[model samples]
Target: MADYDNSRYTYAQVLAGTGYYMKDDKLRYSAGVKTMQTKLNTAGYDSGTPDGKFGGGTDTAVKSFQRAKSLTVDGKAGKATLTELDKTASGGGNASAEAKNLKKKFGSIISSFASKNSIGEDVLGGFILTESSGSGFVDGALKIRFENHIFLKAVPSASTTFKVEDKVHYYKKNGKWYKTHTGKQTSEYEAFNLAKNISENYAYYSISMGLPQIMGFNHKVTGYDTPKAMFTGFSKSEDKQMEGFCTFIVNYSSGSLLKACQSRDFTKMGQIYNGDGSTYGPKLKANAADYAKA
Candidate 1:
């Protein structure tokens, strides 16, 4: 795996530093807004003078930039908008050779699935880039950290199902499952143990696993006969994770989402993939464009 720390900065930092989404009204002037105006002007979006003030002209320019980049047309310079701007201002680099190597490793699988589903390779590539940053693991692990509240919500009464001797929790360590007193265990280990225990007692459908974050409950829709099967498959390799993702997409929306991606209709794609009230569509579209360029 690549050792490069390619993770971007936080959204709040981008907004504060870049004047993203700082619109002019009766409010005070902001330096960030002026910086954004200057950057937009440099990029040929034409935000007028760098007055450190936002108005109709700035809004129009922001919207234009968003449209050109296939971002959400909310006319606000949110995290996605600012990130794109930063990339453009810096003359963004293509995907590293390491990234290319990873892509090549999974190329055949992606291609096969794309062909079977009649989806474009670029679309699938973009999806992977956005969803997993082109990696199935993070920090040398399988990206299987536990989410505490989600586990608690999924399995309410642990005593009945887990059958713990006392106030203890189960977890995984070095490929072996172990149990520890409730407060003594880390959340991450507890999440794994809880998921495993739940799958054994109740059903796997309640757990969410792998790159696509597909839930265990949706095993039927995703073509898995059991939750353990889904979890085990995902744990096998990145290729299997991709397989699970493709399966879910193909079964859930019947290729409509893929079609939306091909057409560059991020609004519809986001609604379908992430459900309503999500702003991820534009970001996904932008990331896909970047991956295609690379």
Candidate 2:
């Protein structure tokens, strides 16, 4: 980063200082935005793009990261926030007691999310099962499936009469999905799901924000109905969402259901049903076996 007068400092300076600029990349804030995105994401904040423009999504993602880390959520990347961010990358150091405290806080966030979203932990379990045993699925698809489960909510048809597809799965891609979990797909469904999940599930605005497009929910969100809390109102923020999702696994997520879902992974998605369990489950497994060329 080139040294310039502080009074004349701009976002460009912030990008340069952060090593996010380059002549080869033209508008270099994208790199800076990526750096910020990685840090914020690691901290459990889900900025939409990490494209390095001072946009609304970035602001919201910053606010969420600040909120999660207990920093002031003014949406401005000030010294304290930047310091914490930098130290976090370097593994947190001699900034102040606040920074050390921030580390502890961040640890708690990961742990909490892990505890709440045991599904995430076990989600790997399910993914591995299908990946290892249910061969013939699209390669690089196992990880994709893992991500799909985190953000989507599978609910039976309103009539509960067992439609062709047992349920329609919905989720937030940016604020809700990416914020809550991890993903990097470029599919149309992925993009649409990303937008829909944010808009429908969390109640954020249904418009583009900054680098990290923090979209609100499109309509309503759906989830399991069990143990009272299992139905909905899972996690709060990035940290808490991870927590809640993990917890849902402990309380309601079923390997059988997951297996069923995995079985259907080879078949057309959204075809597995609830009441037709006896019927669909076997068929799904058979279809997967065929897809595997078994």
Candidate 3:
């Protein structure tokens, strides 16, 4: 167990930078870690000293906080963790108001884009609800999905290891290979660093960007000249990000998915969009129904 303190820390300090504090291949040392430690300690989570190093104590404290808050309990300070931390630190209310605001702001954007793309607004709304629950930003920026396979492919000659759910897997770190489940949810800065270390191309493809979570590698299919260009453009605003998403769906399915969405054929939509016929299809239908009521 760690020691707890009642020293308050500002939300800004805690949320500054990448807003991540996790134990990966190496312990993280950053102001974000220190701020998180301080916040966790203040909240009676016992994160040990407010040091900038993310070790076992910090990880356990983060997990405890997540468990207490009904979060994912991944022991990672991702967007959700940070948001809950901010709310707790500031004594803010639930996210219902924020969700309502996001939905209101997104209505016009979704309507316009869906109209131009010949899709139904309800379908788009359902997708948004499924993907982000009306929250466009994750930890104060666009969402990021780290792709370790792409990163490793870019370095074809380095020795690397990936751990997933208590399993450690080895990689040659050299030569081109693509493997799934190598990626982890991470902040944009950390994901970007992984990409930069590999190559610009890998950086773009190694992570999905924004609300639609479009992969960087699909920039060409999505009508962007380059992955960097797509990333920069999508990060501008929620509207642009959704537009990029719409464009990707149109291009990827050659407009068939849009037709499916228009007809409320969530089964077809899920098959095309998610690449399988699974529970996602019915879940999407349920989401569509709920959004229609809203």
Candidate 4:
């Protein structure tokens, strides 16, 4: 069983019932809550949608778990309750199985890309592993993340053009109240498709698509004619996703990513690809090493 830690939010924040709750008037979203919800579901406690929001269902589930485990009967997920929850949910099969499954399905494709590009298979494999665990398709649909900020950047007038509603946030800064559009919606493809009706190109450009999770705006670097083309291709086949990934690394930033992969420099790779060398670099390196062993 893997040890789940709250690197993003604190235990105190969770217990105070303010950090991860995203229901009704609350708009906070937490990856920590998502992890807990998944584990709770695995341990036979239903936490409803598992949408990274600690709502009423999650509260009920937590209280039920605490009652059963003889922990404090509060709905809050304190350190002890969380630890026990992890232990209970640890029975859900091998955690590394997903990575292994990725290799099993696309080992040949990874090797082909490595050989064609003169890069290490483990490096490429590790990159994919870090991105999607093995499969680019979730329930037969290409894995996608709709970036609301990117959408707004691409189509600044989408709110008026598409008749989309906005979630306005007004905050005091420098003793003046300013309003900003946080997003149209949170991680919902419906909002993305809605925007696509008015401007298909910008809609496609606003999402990170498929196994590699490359943003649609990078279609040129990935050798696609357009963001829509890349999205269509990636949605159809992981083979095309691998092709796009290989192409992206080779061409991104004038081949710097390729150079990094060639030297097995995950720090540089992470810096170039994810803009974070200190943390994502080590993670990619570890994933590559683990893939090699597996």
Model 4: which residue pairs collide? none
Task: Give the poorly placed runs of model 1, Cα more than 4 Å off.
Answer: 1-84, 88-102, 133-142, 145-155, 159-186, 194-203, 254-256, 276-278
Better of 2 and 3 by TM-score: 3
What count of clashes does model 4 give? Answer: 0
How displaced is residue 152 in candidate 1, in Å? 5.1
Kindly report which residue stretches of model 3 are placed more than 4 angstroms away from their true locations once superposed.
1-102, 138-140, 158-188
Candidate 2 per-residue lDDT, tens place, 174-289, comes to 34422222233344235434434344332122221111121122112113332112212322233333333333323332434334343334122213322333323222332222
State, as a TM-score between 0 and 1, how close model 2 is to the true structure.
Answer: 0.26
Candidate achieving higher lDDT, 1 or 3: 3
TM-score for each predicted model, relative to the true structure? 0.59, 0.26, 0.55, 0.58
Candidate 4 to truth, TM? 0.58
What is the lDDT of every predicted structure here? 0.61, 0.35, 0.62, 0.69
Q: Output the lDDT of residue 252, model 3.
A: 73
| Candidate 2 segments exceeding 4 Å error | 1-34, 87-294
Give me the candidate number with maximum TM-score: 1
Error of 3 at 292 (Å): 1.7
* Total backbone collisions for each predicted model: 3, 28, 5, 0
For model 1, residues 1-294, the per-residue Cα lDDT tens digits are: 212111132335665553345454643466666777776765446678877666778877788678767899887777788877766431245753533664677778777887887777766766666566345554544444344334455677643433333545454545664554342225444555555655562334444566666776667566678876777777788788878877776677776776776676666877887773134554555455555555
TM-score of 1: 0.59
